[model samples]
Target chain A: MKRNAAAFGAGALFAVGLALSGMTRPAKVVGFLDLAGDWDASLAFVMMGAIAVHFVAYRVVLRRPAPLFDVRFHLPTRKDIDLRLVLGAALFGVGWGLGGYCPGPGLVSAAAGSLGAIVFVVGLTAGMLIEQAVARALPRRE
Target chain B: MHDFTPIPALIGGAIIGLAASLLLLTHGKVAGISGLYGSLLRQGTSDRAFRLWFIAGLAAMGMLVRLTWPAAFASAWSASLPVTLLAGLIVGFGTQLGNGCTSGHGVCGLSRLSVRSLVATLTFMGTGFATVFVVRHLLGGAR
Candidate 1:
């Protein structure tokens, strides 16, 4: 129960941050994307600040043997560059440039009752479902 | 135009950073939206409750903020639903294929100094640049 509460609290705080940061506003995102127009550099600062905090945070967490939740830090071990990574990045970029909302903000915006957000979430879930189906149908390579 | 100063951007960024850090400290989980959502689909009854509550809290936070600061809601880019849906599908597929989203790889994964994340981030970012180039410049979808 406590863990659940903690998760919910974290999610709520994340949502508030997204709203306060103007991430919920698609125009701001589009402006940032618009290199030729009056560009908005706010997202860059947001990314920088986020990176700075994470740098320090990880240093501290790494000092500890394990995390508070009793699990090893679930960092990815794979290092190879492959088609899946490149293709995924391309698709994400195309979607973001066109819609001006990524998954995090899209989910939060949908919660805020934005019709665009709702559509985005639906499509996102459908995509996930399709991926799962394809993965299931494919023969195991290992 | 959206009026904002460097101060708010910095402050907002810091707050987001702090929140993300705290989440990591407490739950030992990166604030990755895709992983969080994916967990809900894969995990069983024991997991469903927490994920559901977490997602619900995200929605409630938006409502609370909307009630407190109505001005933030004002924006001109209420795009058509179909466009948004298509965009979402692409992002979903991309994240699944890439193994992370912006928050996951861009913020958290990069912080860990993961080379794969670095490559993924660059790819996503570069693709974003190209996409805007095609959409607004070549395609001429101004504003």
Candidate 2:
């Protein structure tokens, strides 16, 4: 119960940061992508700042042997380049270039009651559900 | 390009970094948006109560921000609804196929120095650059 509260608190903080950073706005994203036009390099700075912090913090965390909340770091161990990954990357790029909203920003923007963001989130969630169903239906290879 | 300045951008970046770091510290989970959403889809029941709440809190923050300061929320980008929806569907499919989103892999995963995430991030980013080039120069349709 307490952990849940903490998670919500952390998420709220993240959302607030997204809002303040103008990440929720599609225009900023589009501008960032637009190299010829009046591009906004602000997001780059954001990325840099985030990377710098994570660089230091991750080392500290990894040294602890295990995380505070669990037993291990819980990172993915897969290392394969397949068709699904390539196709997915292409699709994601198309969506981002066209809509200017990725999952994180889309969720944050949806709170603004924008019809576009709402539609995006709904579709995003629906797609996930559909994928799960399809994955379940597939015959087990093992 | 007109009004939003550097101060807000810097402050916002710091805040996001702090929030991400804190989440990592407390929950020991990367603040990857796609993975969180994906988890919600699979796994019927477990220790997911907090994950759902975190998603909800994100929505509420949007509402609060808009209500408190509408001007800061102004955006310049505009596109047809159909286009945006199609784009979103593609992103959804991509996230599933790739096993994560930009936030999941690009930001958090790369930060952790995961080799897979590095490859995925490179692919996505390279694709993004190529997309913009194609859309603006070769195709000359999207805007």
Candidate 3:
């Protein structure tokens, strides 16, 4: 129960940050990506801020033997860079550039009652289901 | 162009990082939204309660912000129906295959100082720039 509560609070705070930082706005996201045109470099600041805080926090928290709630820190273990990784990232980039909505913003905007966001999220769900199916066929990774 | 909000961007981003830190210190989990959502759909994903509660919280916050600060979502992007759907599909499929998105790779993965995350980030950013170039410059549509 405590863990669940923590998760909830974290998600809520994350949404607040995303919205406040203008990440919820697709136009701002694309504008940052638009290098040729009058580029808005605000997204860089977002990243810089996020990374700066996280870099220190991650190290400090990791120094503890374990987390407060869990016995072990559950983290992704795979380290190899393969075709799947590169191809998948490149494909994701195309979609992000075209729509300017990654998973977080897409879900948030959809819940915020944007019609276009709803459409995009529906497509995103379908795509995820499709990827799940494909992943099953390929060698599954942890 | 929207006014450059460096202050809000930096502060909001710090909040995001703080949230991630809290989750990590408390639960020992990386706060990757894509990974959280994607794993929920799997057949036997353990730790189901956390994922559900987290996503529910995200949606709840969104609804709350809608009532309070509508302008945050004011500039919702809308393209042709087909294009919008296709873009969503690609993003979904790609993130799942890649095993992370901005939050996962950009925020958490990068924080760990992982080389894999770095490469993935550059790859996606590169293609993002290229795709935007094609759409805005070549195709004459990016608005």
Candidate 4:
């Protein structure tokens, strides 16, 4: 119950931040992506601010042996930069450039009942589902 | 950039960072939206309750903002229906395959000093730049 409450609060705060930063708007997102033409660099500030805060906050919070509500910190262990990561990122970037929405903003905007957001989210879900299917169908290489 | 608004951007970013930090501190989990949402769809996964609550919070907040302050939430991007749909599909697939997006890899993973996240971020940014150039300048997709 406490963990769930924390997650909910965090999500709400995140949504508020995304909207306040103008990230929920597809045009604002694309404006930042538009390098050649008239570019809007506001979102860069958003990234910088977020990184700065998290950079310090993470180190501080991590000093504790365990999370306030959990047994241990659940963090990613992967370090290698593989083909899949690069290709997947490249593909995601193309989509981002094309659509002006990533997962976070996409979800937020979709929640607001924007037609564009809804369409993009549907495609996003379909894409994810398809990827999962493909991954399963492919032979595993351990 | 003439449209640069640093104050709001910084504040908003800080809020996002704070939220991510809170989640980490309390739940010991990275606030990766794509991962959270994807896991909910996958079978045999635990922690469905937290995911549902988190997503619900996001939606409720969004709806609240839309209703309370419409002006502050307006956007300017306008693309064709087909273009938007295709872009959506690509974004969904790419993020899933990549295992993260802006929030996951860009914010949370990068904060952890993950090399994988760094490489992923660079690649996505590069491709995004290239795609925008092609779509807007070359193909005249939209202005």
Please report the candidate that would top TM-score against the real structure.
4
TM values, all candidates: 0.91, 0.89, 0.96, 0.97
Q: Residue-wise lDDT of candidate 3 within A1-142, one digit each (tens)?
A: 8888998998898899899998888888888888997688998888888999999999999999999989988878889998778888899999989888889888888889987788889998888889999888887664
List the candidates ranked by TM-score, beginning with the highest. Answer: 4, 3, 1, 2
Model 2 spans with C-alpha error above 4 angstroms:
A139-142, B1-7, B43-45, B136-143
Best to worst by DockQ, what's the order? Answer: 4, 3, 1, 2
Cα displacement (angstroms), candidate 3, residue B70, comes to 0.4
For B11-72, candidate 4 gives per-residue lDDT tens digits of 99999999899988998888888888887777787878878888888988988988988754
True contacts recovered per prediction:
0.65, 0.60, 0.77, 0.81
Runs of candidate 3 exceeding 4 Å displacement: A140-142
Q: 1 or 3: which has the higher DockQ?
A: 3
lDDT of 2 at B142: 59
Indicate which candidate wins on lDDT: 3
The candidate that wins on DockQ is 4
Local distance difference test, candidate 1? 0.74
- Tell me the DockQ of each model, to 2 decimals: 0.66, 0.60, 0.78, 0.82
Q: Residue-wise lDDT of candidate 1 within B24-100, one digit each (tens)?
A: 77666677777677566552524466567667777888778777875454567555678778888888878877778
* Per-residue lDDT of model 3, residues B16-80, tens digit only: 89988988998899988878888898889998998888888888899999999999887744566
Residue pairs with backbone overlap in model 2: none
Q: Model 3's CAPRI class?
A: medium
Per-residue lDDT tens digits of candidate 2, residues B1-143? 55335666677766776666766776777888877877887878455876787788787788888788875457666657877777777788788877877777766777888777777777776676666667766776555
